[model samples]
Target chain A: MSNAISLRGLEKTYANGHQALRGIDLDIKHGEIFALLGPNGAGKSTLIGAVCGLVKATGGSIHIDGHELPRQYREARAKVGLVPQEMVNEGFESVLSSVRFSRGLFGKPPAPKLLEQILRDLSLWNKRDDATMTLSGGMRRRVMIAKALAHEPQVLFLDEPTAGVDVELRRDMWAMVRRLRDRGVTIVLTTHYLEEAEEMADRVGVISDGRLLLVENKTDLMARLGRRQLRLQLQQPLTQLPADLAGFPVELVDQGRELVLDVARDNQGIADFLRRLAANDIDFKDLHTSESSLEDIFVELLRKPA
Target chain B: MNFYSIHAIFRFEMARSVRTLMQSLAAPVLATALYFVVFGSAIGSRMAEIGSIPYGSFIVPGLTLLAVLTQSVSNAAFGIYMPRYSGAIYEILSAPLSPTEIVFGYVGAAVVKSMVLAAAILITARVFVPYEVAHPFWAFFILLLCAVSFSMLGFIVGLCVDGWDKLEVVPSLVITPLTFLGGSFYSLNMLPPTWQTISLFNPVVYLVDAFRWAFFDVTEFNPMVDVAFLLGFLLVCIVIVGQIFRTGYRLQH
Candidate 1:
């Protein structure tokens, strides 16, 4: 089947001569969780806005579920949903009315039962009659999500979904997102939290300076770029490393109390390295191995020259 | 042609107004009622009749049109402006909605609101003084034209201004003063020739005159000119509105 959402050579230059997006090309597949990671002013929001039809792209073509933008906009837009960063609500209007308004704006026939189910899913059914402004900040954000889902869109774009929520709520939201994915809705979210992408995304994309640095499978990316460390607590302190073990990539930490050896995860030869250390009469009281986290990989990727 | 979206926006706006009934519906009606009590009851009892019609009855068309114009501009302005202020505008902008549909949603609501206020004012005026509409069809037409025109003007205001003060500036500083100067309370015939010539420069003068003519059948200007003025004002606002949507003005960036 075709990609759920597609973009080719997307470019946007504001009237002030600021270029927000530079040649962005991406495809989001159905039923997959894709996370876009970028730093401030790196064009992540611009890319999302362009795809959602909020920002007019200067160049490029957007296709949503086989419908092209600016031409088949009605059909294309009908398939997409966006949960923006702002916690805006109709202060005087009830939560239910707000969601209904969103459903209507998307040209959907009113389905009261479906709307109620969405509110229930968001845990907003109890607050349906309350004015939106009376809710807490987290509750307001949930209301935003309900509005996005009101139309039952096929492709959902969530911009910083867990920006300001508490950890428990964040986990709940992640579970909710996974349920949506299981039901076959394509999910694309942009986030500053690497852990969010690490935990939620099936595929990871790193963007910097308005260009996508790389897009790869999450597990493959971590295994390929993630480095491992074998930290051994030495049995006895030594002044320096022995010439015999100089071939190994190692460093002394904890004032020479421990030896840390760098290891490539997929290409690790810990057995040979351990045998060599035994042959050299070097002994360690205890040792442990650790791999680089997604945060590490993110920092390493961004630290590289664009 | 997203009529559903337009209808959704209309319902949303109407609900918003209903939620604030005391402010939106009751306040304007009360404000207009004060005009009837003060001008029609208090002053008209002592003043001479203008053009063989009771001074109280003569002011009906002018005051009714005044309410429509101010309410149209204010309602349309606030309808779109509040969304921007609260950042809820993104939903509609991103929806598969054409610019025309968005305008129809917002401006349509504004016009409906103004017409309702006009009707409320006319009914309230009945309690203070009696009046007759000589050309009822013409009167409704003028009220509609006035509502649609000023509502568009309000839409433009919403799109063009950024700050709340700026939003209120057009309605309070400009439109209200223009209405007052446009003979909403007195006729241009009552003014000297120089002042009368100057009054013609005020667009509200034409609207008020046309509406008054519909009620009293007395006007200083030709009826066609009044119709042309309303149509021309509406055309200009529509063009400007089209330009704003085309360029995305403050709505996009």
Candidate 2:
């Protein structure tokens, strides 16, 4: 099947000469939750803006389900929805009216039931009559989601949907996103929260310095770059590492009270290292194995020289 | 050409106006009524008639123009500016609506508001001073032209300014002074030759003269010249607003 969204050499350089995006080429699959992982000022928002037609691309093109943007913009834009990072709503307008108005903007006939359902799904039905300004921050974020879904868009771009949200709302949002993907809607989200990407993304794309560093299947990316560590708490204070275990990737930490062993996920070196430690009579109070998270991989990726 | 989009924006903006009726509608009407009470009743009885029209009746078109011009700018400017200020403009920007449709919705609503205010001012003026329109069609023509043109100017102003204070500068300082000097209270004929020549450069003068002629069939400049100038100004505003949308000037960034 064709890609849900496609960009070829997409670029954006502000008039002030800030290159927000440079030569970004990406294709998002249908019904997949693609998480764009990037730090602040890494062109995540800029990429989304260009696709949604809010920011003009200085060069290259974007095609939304085979329709070119800004030319066939009406048709192209009809297929996509955006929930911006900023919490902006028509504050004085009721939640229902605001969402209904958004649906109307897409030239859709008023579907009261669909809007009601969306509001219900986002748990905003109770506040449908309330002015958006009266809503709590979390409720307002849900309202933003309802507005984005109002037009029944096939593809949704959520720019940091859970930023500053409480844990409950964040979990609720993640569940809602999973439900959206289950319904065959392609989801592209940009987030600073690595755990969000780790927990929700089907595919993960890392972007840094206006460049797309890598795009890979979530599990594959994790397994390829993820590291495992064995931390040993020494029973007694040790002055330094044992000479016999110098061949292993072990470092004494916590004022020589702990020994840390770094090993690859697929490496069998840990068993041999443990046998060698026993043979050398190294005593430890306890030991625990920890694996590197997506956060660790992301930080490591960004820390590398471009 | 998306009527649904245009209607959505128009209805939403109109609803906002209804919600703030006091500030959006009543305030302008009451202000115009006060102008009539002060300028028409207090001062009219002492002044001589100008061009066979009573002093009270003569200032009616000028006063109405003043209220409509100021309201047109303020209404349209605030309508667009509020969305930008609140960041709600993203919804409009990301929608399927074209630039022209967006402008149509905003400028269209602004025109409706200014027209309503103009009508209210005209009806209120009748309570304080007696007046009749010699050419009702031309009167409405000038009224609409002024409202739409000034609203477009207001749209441009809203796009250009970044803050609330800057929004007020054009309507308060520039438009108010221009309308006062545009002969809203007195005709250019009342001024000396040099001053009349200088007053000719004031664009509001043409609008006031056209509207006054529509009411009293009396004007210093040719009715055709006033109409031409009004259309010209309207066209210019359309071009500038069109360019703003086309280039996504402040709207995009």
Candidate 3:
């Protein structure tokens, strides 16, 4: 099957001559959670806006479920939903009415039972009659999701859905997202929390400076781009580097009491690093290895130009 | 164009607006009552009848339309403005709604709100001046038309405006002045012939004259001519606002 969402050479520029997105090309698969990772002003929102027809694309084209945007907008948009970054709703509105109205906006007939099911899924069933402003921040966020899911679109976009939410709510939201994925909803999310992306996304795309730096499967991307660090505790402290250990790519720490070495992600490099440490007669009290996390890779990607 | 969808949106908007009763309905009605007590009873007691109707009755049509006009415009403008301000418009924009549905939903709800206010003012006016509706059907038709037209106008203004201050500008400077000069408290017949001719230039005059004609069966100007003018104004507003929605002017963003 074709990709659920496809972007080709997408470029967006604001009226003030600020370029938001520059020639972004990407494909998101159906039924998978795709995470777009970026820093502030990196065009993650702009990218989602372009797909959902909120922002006009300066150049290039977008296809939603094989339908072109701004031309086939009605059909393309009907299949997708977006949860924006801000908290927006009528404070006086009931949760049920808000979600029901969202369904009506999609030209769907009033379906009270379906709306009830949605509210139930989001754990907002009890608060259905409550005014939105009376609810807590987390509950309001759930209302946003319930509103987006009212029409049961094929794809959903969560833009920092858990920015300031508490731990329990965040975990609950992730579980709900997983349930949606299980039910065949393709989710595209943009988040500053690399850990969320790392835990949820099947494929990850890093965006920086309005350009896409990389798009790879979570496991493959980590294995291919992931780096490991080996910290060796020295037996004796010294003022300067030892002569024999100079050939190894290592840095001294704790006044020569420890050695920090960056090893390739490959299996052989780790073994070779170990062999070299032994050959150099380096005495270490302890050693620990750590793989580079998504946060580390995300920071690195931002520092490098696309 | 689909009635059901528009109805859903219309109902949603109406519920939202009415929920804020203190600001939307009560405040405007109370203000209109004070206007009647101060302007209608005070000044009306001194002024003589104009065109076979008491000054208070003559002003009633204008005041009614004024209530309808401002409330209509504000209901739609604020309804749209709040969503845009709160960033909730993103939710609506991303939904399956078309601009037409969105516009009509908001404008329709505005008309409903203005009508509710009109009803309240009409009832309150009965308490102050025991005036009866001369041609109740015509009166109802004219009020409905005025409400819908101004509500559509407000919808256009709301979509084009960016900030809160911009939202209040059109209603504050334009609608208020137009209603005052539209002969709400005085008759064009009371003015000099030349000024009377100039008064005809005010689009609101046609609405006020037509509304008064519906109630008293008497008007300073020809009722047929005034109706034609009001109908023309309504058509123009519809066309312009419809074009704004069609072109996505200032709204799609």
Candidate 4:
């Protein structure tokens, strides 16, 4: 089957000459949770807007489910939905009507049952009759999600779904996302929280400076870039490093009282390195290991040349 | 061609109007009714007649056009502007809707509102000034045309501007003043020679002339010319509105 969304040579430059997207080419598989991680002004939102037809790309071809955009726009857009970073529910419209309105806006026939299910899934059924302006911030966000889901879109773009919410709300959002993916809906999201991406993303794409730097399976990205640090506490202080262990990535620290070995998380030479350390007469009273979190890898990736 | 989307947006706008009855409906309707009471009956009754028509009855068509024009422009602006101001317009722009369907929803709702206000004013005028319509169907048709035309202009106004303060500029500073000088309260021939020439430059003059011709079969300008002018104005509004959407002027990122 074809990918859920495909973009090629996508570019967006504002009239003032600020380029928001620079030649983005990507394909998002169906029914996968893809998280786009980027800092502010990293063009994440611009990319989402272009896919959803909210922003016009300066140059590119976009196909959503095999339908080209700005040409077969109606057909292409009908298959996608967007939950923006900002909530827009200040109208006196009730939650139920707003969701129903979104369904109709997508050219869908009125489906009360589906709307009910969406509202219920978002935990907004109880507030269906209340005016949206009267709801709390979290409830309002849920209403946005419900609106996006009301049309039964095949692909959903969530921009910062959990930017500043509490832990419970964040977990609830993750659960809702998983539920949607289980229903065979593709989920593409952008977020500032690396932990959220680590916890929820099946595949991750790191973007910066209007370009995608890397796209990889979450596990593979973690294993490849996540390093392990081995710290050894020496039995006695030494002023110099052991000459026999020169081949290993070992550095003396703590005033020569300890040796720190840096290696890839998937490295298989740790046991050999230990045997060599013993042969070299290096004595350690204790040792411990720590792994790099996603945050660290992300920072290091950004700090290096693009 | 998304009829469902059109219906959805239309119904949403109508529901909002009903929800804010006092601000959207009652206040404007009541103000239009007062014009008929204060100007059409209480004030015009003592004034001299023009062209053998009672002064009270003479002002009905002009005032009706005035009511629809101002109300349609303001209502259309407000209907679309609120969503933009509150940042709810993203859903609208992102939806699978064509420009015609979107305009149909927002402008259609505004036209309906202006018609309701026009109808209310008619009823209110009947309770005060006795009036007759030589071509009531034509009157309704002209009023409908006016509503749709000005409502389209209002739609453009809503999309072209950024702030709330700018939204009111068209209805208040432009439409209201134009309608007032467009022979709404006095006959075009009553103006001084130069002012009458200047009044001809105002577009609202033709709208009032056509509407009054529908009511009394009497027109200050040639009836055919006014009708042609009205159609031309409607075409201009439609073209400008279409351009606004096609270019995504202020509606897109």
Q: With candidate 1 superimposed using the best TM-score fit, by how many Å does residue B184's alpha carbon deviate from the native?
A: 2.0
Residues A1-306 of candidate 3: C-alpha lDDT, one tens digit per residue: 778999999999987899999999999999999999999899999999888767878899999999888788778888998888888856788899888878887777888999999899888999999999899989999999999899888999999988999999899989989999999999999999999999999999999889999999998988777888888888876677767667667789987898888876664456676777778677778989888999988888777765
In order, the interface RMSDs are 1.2, 1.0, 2.0, 1.1
lDDT of 3 by residue, B115-211 (tens): 8889999999877775778889989988998888888878877877889998888787899898899888887877899988888788888888888
Against the true structure, what is each candidate's TM-score?
Answer: 0.96, 0.94, 0.90, 0.95
Best by lDDT: 2
lDDT of 4 by residue, B1-253 (tens): 8789999999999998888778876776688678878887788878899898888888888888877887888889888988888888888888888999999999999999888888878887788888888988888888998999899888888888889899889988998899999998999899999999999899999999989999888988886788788788889999998888788788777
- Taken over the whole model, the C-alpha lDDT of each candidate is 0.89, 0.91, 0.84, 0.89
Candidate 1 CAPRI assessment class: medium
Regions of model 1 farther than 4 Å from truth: A243-247, A266-268, A275-281
Q: Is candidate 3 or candidate 4 better by DockQ?
A: 4
Candidate 2 residue runs with Cα over 4 Å from true position: A234-284
Worst 10 residues of 1 chain B by lDDT: B62-71
Model 3, residue B28: displacement in angstroms? 3.6
- Candidate 3 is graded, for docking, as medium
Sorting all predicted structures by TM-score, with the top scorer first, yields 1, 4, 2, 3
RMSD, model 2, all Cα superposed?
A: 2.3
